[model samples]
Target chain A: MTGKAHCYKRDHINTDEIIPARYLNMDREADLAQHAMEDIDPEFVKKINQGDFIIAGEDFGCGSSREHAVWALRGAGVRAVIADTFARIFYRNCVNNGFLAIECPGISQQVDSGDELEIDIEKGIIKNRTKGDQYTFQPITGFAREVIGAGGLLNYIAGKVV
Target chain B: MGATITEKILAAHCGRTQVNPGELINAEIDVIMCHDVTTTPAIDMLTDRGLSRVAHPERVVVIPDHFVPNKDIKSAEMVAKIRRWAKEQGIDKFYELGRHGVCHALLPEQGYVRPGITIVCGDSHTCTHGALGAFSTGIGSTDLAATLATGKLWFKVPETILFRLNGKLGKGVYAKDVILEIIRQIGVDGALYKAMEFTGELIDELSVEARMTICNMAIEAGGKSGIINPDQKTINYVEAHTAEPFKIFKSDSDAEYCRIVEINVTDLEPLVAFPHLPSNGKPVWQVGEIPVDQAYIGSCTNGRIEDLRVAAEILKNRQVAKNTRMIVVPATTNIWKQANQEGLLDIFMAAGAAVSTPTCGACLGGHMGILAAGERCISSTNRNFIGRMGSPQSEVYLASPATVAASAVAGKIADPRNYM
Candidate 1:
């Protein structure tokens, strides 16, 4: 998959900023889409289209196990998120919600905001198309990959139980 | 090979004779909890997947504490739906509003959590149960649905970090200060995906409540869970509430740890985490006199009985600052009842503080004591992230209950030592 990077060059981006608490009462993903990342970047929704990526520094998606953070990002047409590292619960939430979350150390330093990037999920390679450089990352493997391949844990469990 | 406490617990629950770090296994869960905020979404996902029955309905506990007393009609409807679902599912463990407290505190108080078991919840602070030596961690709504459907979930055995705490705590220094200092030393993500096993002389000397306070905020430092080996204090506390049998596991003497760090709390003082991050910790003496508009003393982190007593002691016969508003929330109804019976609630009332029911109110900026733009608050809650308590322009300083109470009385970020 390929997308243009929307870089937020900061560390420890928490879920509260990804989707504020005031908007958490909603039940629909579409209702949460507009407010996604608005706390950190007010025009975040207007700056992106389908199949975009969020490139961030270390400790991305920290604080709170609110899955609404992932839902909001997915609904905003973000295909994947690339960060130096992710908070544990957020990484699991990303995989469980059928959204791609990649961790590439020193990735933020290599690519600029709006840089074109290509990712090969199966091969675990990230290509900065704009910089003409490639980096290898640890791919989601084993049961985690299987769960994500089935479009989240719900479908994986449905298949297993049935 | 020797195993850590977490490995021992996971192995026991998975029915495996042995396991190690990085080994993926599906372990049976002893309890699963969902609160008001996440229950609606979890129920929706479960029903959408065409699942009608929970694998072990009796093991599932639902508590409506997040938006209890129903903030509005929408919240009321959400609570109603969960109540209906619990009834339809015959989930007798469900605790409705006013019947229970916050999910994290209520679980342990009601004997739902035991040592050497695995617990999963939809809330992030599920690590609080690890204080009892359980392998507890938080999961998402989808994972909650899967566990509800199957009674088991996948887990990657995590490497362990041993925090060896030693020395006697100084006057006004608290478990909250120790934990905040740990977070300050090791940035927010220092222990990502790792189990934090707290051991040492100081931890053994602390009450179970204080241990719970320490473990509850392990998630703030990016730990998957925080644990302390169950000692006589834990046994005595659990025995009073539960007759059910439970195992007590310990790390092997030679067990390998990813890293071992020692923190000596002999001369530690009260600490306050600055705005926007828990890692931005500063000793109370170092932080200058900053004014505060509000002071809140409650959350899964520091809303236990001991926390209340500390606050009560500081506020006794002293009025809160006229310019500052203070709200105190017990972590559980049991704690509230005990505080009221002990006249602690009376002390707070006389001190011009508002005592509210047990909820995660205002901690997540949901309700009760939200701040206005450019306002500042001194809170005992865990996180002090930007906009966490209200407007992004507002600031939150996190400290122990004593520090919060003292700050309330002084109308600013005052040192708890002064009040002591």
Candidate 2:
């Protein structure tokens, strides 16, 4: 996907910050996305464009294993999340919800906000389409790759059954 | 080629002779658990799948713990729905307010959880049962809904990480501290999707409550589960409360481990996870003058009778800091009664601490003790994630019960050593 990378230059962006527990009442995925990151940075949703990638520092998505966090990101049109590392629950939620959670440890140092970038999960490379800098990362595991490729766990299971 | 307790349990659940890391397997779930807060969603999904009958109705447990007395009309409606759903679904083990306790405490105490079985719960603290040598982990609502419809779960057998702690723990340093130090070493995500097996003399020395505390925070380290091999402690605990027999599992001497992290507990000091992250930690001595507006000691992490006893011992003859509000909530009604009989409640009351009933009152800021804007709290609960204890403007510092009690007395974030 091609888009301006709306990077969040912070560490330990917990689930509560991504989607607060107060919004748990909203059952729909799309409604939850409108308030995503409202707890940390109120302007997050307004500044975000479609198909932006989130690059974070260590321990991203640490906290409660609420699936709404993934829904919020997906609703906000987040295509991929490349972080140094992810909390296990958040990683699983991302995989189950079809959002790409890439492990590009130390990728936070490479780009700035509004820096146009392109991430190719199939090619196992991220090109800094703006700075002319490119980096390689190990591909997601075979099972995780398949799940992401299939759009989600439920989708993957459905596809497998079909 | 013998297997460790974890491997044996996984194999038994997987219905296989041998199980390897990274292999996907569907396993029989011995117990399916849900609380009031998360049960509604799982139930909706289960009903959506046209599931008229549960695979094993008696094996499922529903507990209304988050808002025990139904904090508000909304909380009341949520719990009432769960109780009604459980009855309709033919689940026999439904514990309502006054009868219910924390899911982790009620599970093993009721003898529903035994070794050599796989358990799945909608809550992340489900791994707390792994202290008894069961293969258990938390699942998302979608996966939980699937498990509810069909009493099974799919898992990718993870490589095992070994943690070996030897020597004796110093005074005022307990299992809570040990877990905090472990989180400090293996950042929050270091052990993502890996199994952590605790072994060594220290494991033998720790009590069941202490062991549960260690395994409970395995989620904080980003591990699938934390487990210890069942031994005499496990046997005794099961035998004392349960009449049913159990088949325990132990680790083999030659079982392979992905990585081994060793620690010498004798020299270790109490640790704290500062505001905003469970893995953001430093030694207790290094943290100075971080004031706390509230001090809470409860939750599945440190809400047991033993933990309450330790806090009561420290608060017996002292008064709390005038500015700090200390709240103590027992894990269960039985624990509350036991503390009452032992005069622990009086000790806390005399020290100007509010003793709440058995509920997960303020752990998630769902009800009582919710922090106002810009307030700070030092608590013994798991996860200091933002807005965990209430307002987004507030900050939470995670620590041991002793440290929390001490901080309450000092008005600032003080380690247990200063009081001891």
Candidate 3:
């Protein structure tokens, strides 16, 4: 996957900032997309495009188990999220929702905002197109990768169950 | 090799004799908790997939406490939708508003949680069940939907980090302070993807309510779950609530741990987590006299009967400060009834504090006593993140119920030792 980076340089960017609690009442995915990252960056929606990536520091999605955080980001055409680490539940939600989340050590320092990057899930390499830098990260392995490859856990399970 | 409590429980649920850390296994879930906030999305996902009928309706427990009393019309409609779906599915454990309280608190009180079982809930505070020795953790709605369709989910056996707390707690130094100190020592992600098994004499001496409070905030440290081996106190508490059969498991004395953290509580004072992060903790004495506009005492974290008693003891005859508004909420309807029976509610009402019904009101900035812009609140609830209690510009200080009550009386962040 190749995309432009939308960098959020801080650590522990909790779900409350990714998508605030007030918008949780909206059941539709499209309605949630409009408010993605509104709390942390009001102009985030305007800056994002299809297949863009979110670069964050450690413990991304640290608060709340609301899947709206994933839904909103996915709805806003986010291809994947690259962070130093992610909260356990949020990491699982990303896999189940087929929203890819990559754990790259010192990723925030390597990629600048608007820097173009290419991610090869199978190769486990992230190449920075703007800075001409290359970094290697551990790709999603084992059953988790299979789930994401099938587009989601439900789809993966459906294939196995039938 | 001897297994930790969490490993044993997960192995048992997986129909295996033994399991190791990092091994993936499919485990049967003993209970599944779904709240109103996540139910609509889960149901929508299930419908979109053309799947009808939940796999095991009997194993699913539904509670509508997050936005109960419906903060707005949309929230009301969501609750009604949950009611209709739960009723149609014949999920007898579904507790409507006014019947149940926060799902995390209500589960243990209603005997739905027990030791040596694997449980999953759609809320992060599900780790609170680990206080009873259950292997519980939170999952998102998609995972909840998967669990609803099949009474099983995959789990990675997490490595254990033993936290050995020693010494005795001083006056006004509660379990909240101990956990906050631990979080302060280890940054927010210190125990990422690991089980935090609390041990030692101090933890054994803590009440089940205090244990729950400690386990409830384990997520704040990025733990998969916080657990304590089931003891007589746990068994007795579970037995008093229900006659359901349960298993008990304990980690071997010589079991290996990825890391062991030693914490001493003898000199620990009441601690408060400053704004923006739970990891940003300091002793109450060092926080100075920061004025507060509101003081809240409730949430699944510290809204139990014992917590209410602590608050009532501090607010007995004195009224809350004129500049401060105090909101006290009991965790469960049963807790509310017991507090009223014991006259704790009368003491709070007489102290000029507004006592609310059993709900997670204002804890997640849901409703009821939300702070306005630039306002500051001292809360007994977990998580003091920015915009957690209301406006983004508002601030919150996290403390114990006793500290919250004392601060309410002083209109500032005050130490509970003076009032005690």
Q: For residue B309, what is the lDDT in candidate 2? A: 93
Off by over 4 Å in 2: A117-121, A125-128, A132-142, A145-151, A155-162, B51-53, B418-420
Deviation in angstroms for B230 in model 1?
Answer: 0.6
The DockQ of each candidate is 0.78, 0.42, 0.78
Give me the iRMSD of candidate 1, please.
1.0
lDDT order of candidates, best first? Answer: 3, 1, 2
RMSDs, each prediction? 1.1, 2.5, 1.0
lDDT of 3 by residue, B255-279 (tens): 7799999988999999999998999
* Tens-digit lDDT string for candidate 2 (B299-386): 9999999999999888879999999999999888788888899999999999999999878778877777999999999999998887
Model 1 lDDT per residue over B301-328, tens place = 9999999999999999999999999999
The candidate 3 chain B region of ten consecutive residues with least summed lDDT is B44-53
Q: Which of 1 and 2 is ahead in TM-score?
A: 1
TM-score of chain B of 1: 0.99
Worst lDDT 10-window in candidate 3 chain A: A153-162
Docking class of 2: acceptable
Q: What stretches of model 3 exceed 4 Å from their correct place?
A: none
Candidate 3 per-residue lDDT over residues A12-130, each given as its tens digit? 99988888888877868789999998878999999999999999999999989999999999899899999988888899999998889999979988899999999988889999999
> Could you tell me which residue pairs clash in candidate 2?
none
